[model samples]
Target chain A: MKSLQELEEIRNKTRESVYLRKDRAGIRVVVGMATCGIAAGARPVLLAFLEEIKKRNIKNVTVTQTGCIGVCRLEPMVEVYLPNQEKVTYVNMTPDKVSKIVSDHIVNGQPVMKYTIGVDGR
Target chain B: MEDLSLHILDIVQNSISAMAETIRIAVMEDDTNDRLTVLVEDNGRGMTEETVKKALDPFYTTRTSRRVGLGLSLLGAAAEFCGGSLIINSQPGKGTSIEVWFPMSNIDRPPLGNMTDTIITLIVCNPDIDFIYEHSTPGGKFVFDTRLVRREVQDIPLGEPDILEWIRSYLSEGLNEIRGGA
Candidate 1:
C-alpha cells in the first residue's frame, strides 16, 4: 500500500518530469476496469503495462483505466494512445499481450499490427 | 476477481456484511518454507455445510443480480495455479475461516498488489464492519484494528473521507515498517 502522500508524490513527479499531455499527447494505454472488465479479467492486463513500464523503466508512457468502454464483448480491452494517431483499440488481451505491446510498440515504435483492432479482421 | 488479492478481499467483504464485528486477516511469508499464506477469519454469521459447499461454485450467489459469481471460484483457481489450495471452514452460528496458500516462486501467480488499498476500500465502504489486519514475515509484523480507533472517536464512521484517508495512510506507514516498501 502506498500512502496518499506517496501517491501524490508519484503524481507530482509524473507531472513535473513526465511529459504532460494536453489531453491529446503522450503514449497512453487505457485499460477498461469497470465491473464487466474485472469479471472478464482486466486487472492482469492493466498490471502487465504497469510491470512492463517499471521493468523497462519507460518514463514517457502513462497507464490508466476507464469504466465500461461500451465494448462488453471485449471486456478486457485496451486502447493505445499514440500522439496524432488513431486510438487503436485492442481486445481479448492477456497480460502477455500487454508485454508484447509494450516491447514492440511503445518501446520499439512498431505497433503490433496483428493485435490492433484494425487488423483483427472484425 | 482476476486480481488474486481482490478475490481475497471480496470474501472478507462478505464476512463483514454477514454481521461480523471483528475480523482478523493474516498474510504470512514463510520464506523458510518458500510459501505465502493468507488467512481471513471472521466471527460472523456462518453458513451450513451445504451453503459452504455451494459457495465455491461459480453459480452460487446470495444476490440476484446475475447468474454467476466468480469471486470464490477465481480465488480457488488462483491458489491451484500457484501450486497451492484454498480452504474454507465454517460452523453455523459461530464463524467462518478462509485460507489461501501460494507458492512463493510460482511464475504465473499474480502480485498481491496494494493490500493497503484493499483494506482501505473495505474500511471505507463498510464503516460498521471492523477489521483487524495483520501481516507477518520472517522479520516483523504489522497490525491494524478499527475498533481501537472507534474507542476514541466513539463510533465515528470509517467512511468519512478524512478518516478513511487516515486509515489508508496508517496502513501504508505500518506496511512500510514491516516491509521496506508499502
Candidate 2:
C-alpha cells in the first residue's frame, strides 16, 4: 500500500515548479463529460490527455471537464482554449488521437485542422 | 454506461455541476452476503421532491443544452437489472445521498471497472473540491480523503502532474490490496 510519505516527497519536488507556473496564462483543455460523453468513452480520452500532458511534462496546460457541448452525436468532444486564441472544438475524440493533439496543437501551437469541428462540419 | 464506475463518474459530474464542495464515494463488497453496495453523498444544492421524480425520468432534464438526463436513470436501470435497488434521499438546502446495491453474484451486474480513473479524473479536474473514497472488501478496507492531502501539500494544487501521478498509484495499489492483492 502507498503511504502519505510518498505524496509528501512528490509535493516537495514539484512545489517550486507549480508555484512558478501559477502566474502564467496557460492553455486549457476541456473534455465534455456529460452522460452522452461518458457513454461514448470520454473518460479514456480525458485520461489520455492527462497522461500525455504529464508524460510530456507540459506544465502550462490545464486539462478539465465540462458538461454537454450540445452535440450528442459527437459525444466525446474536446475543446482547447489557448491563451489568446479562439477556442478549437474537436469532435469524436478518442484516446488514439490524444498524442497528436498534444504534440501538434499543445506543444507546437499548430491546431490539427482536420480534426476540428469546423472541418468535420459539425 | 459499460460499468458501474462509469455510472459513478457520470453521477459525480452531476454533483460537480450542482457545485458540491465535498463528495463521498463508498464501495462495499461482502462475499459471504453476496452483496455489493455503492454510495455517493454530496454537499450540493439538493433537489426538490418534484425535481427528484423528474430526475428518474430519462426524458426530463433541467438543462436547456440537452433534453435528456440519463445519468441517474441509467444507473437506476443498471441496479434494477442486477436484482438491486437505487435510493435517493435529499432535502432542499441540505444535500443528496444516492445509494445503490447489487447482488454480487448476479451475472448481469457490470464490473466495477477502473475506479482509479474515475477518482483521479474527478480530483484533477475539480482541484478545489474534496473527495473521500472508501472501499472495503472481505480482505481489508482502504480510505482516501483529499482533505488530509490538501493539508500536507499546502500551496501545491492537487492537479499538479506529480501529485496526480502519486494519487493514481496510491489508489491503484490501495484498491488492489483491499481486493486481496494483485
Best by TM-score: 2
Q: Per-residue alpha-carbon lDDT of model 1 for B108-155, expressed as tens digits?
A: 777777787667655644567778889987768988887766654443
What is candidate 2's fraction of native contacts?
0.81
Error of 2 at B6 (Å): 0.4
lDDT (Cα, 0-100) at A115 in candidate 2 = 85
Worst 10-residue lDDT window for candidate 2 chain B reads B60-69
Local distance difference test, per candidate? 0.72, 0.90
Question: Candidate 2 regions off by >4 Å?
Answer: none
User: In candidate 2, how many Å is residue A77 off?
Assistant: 0.6
Tens-place lDDT digits, model 1, residues A1-122: 53344434333444433323334346888876544666687666765676677677665675666655776676688888877777878887788888889988887777888887677636
TM-score, cand. 1 vs. native: 0.60
TM-score per prediction, in order, is 0.60, 0.97
Q: Could you give me the TM-score of model 2 versus the true structure?
A: 0.97
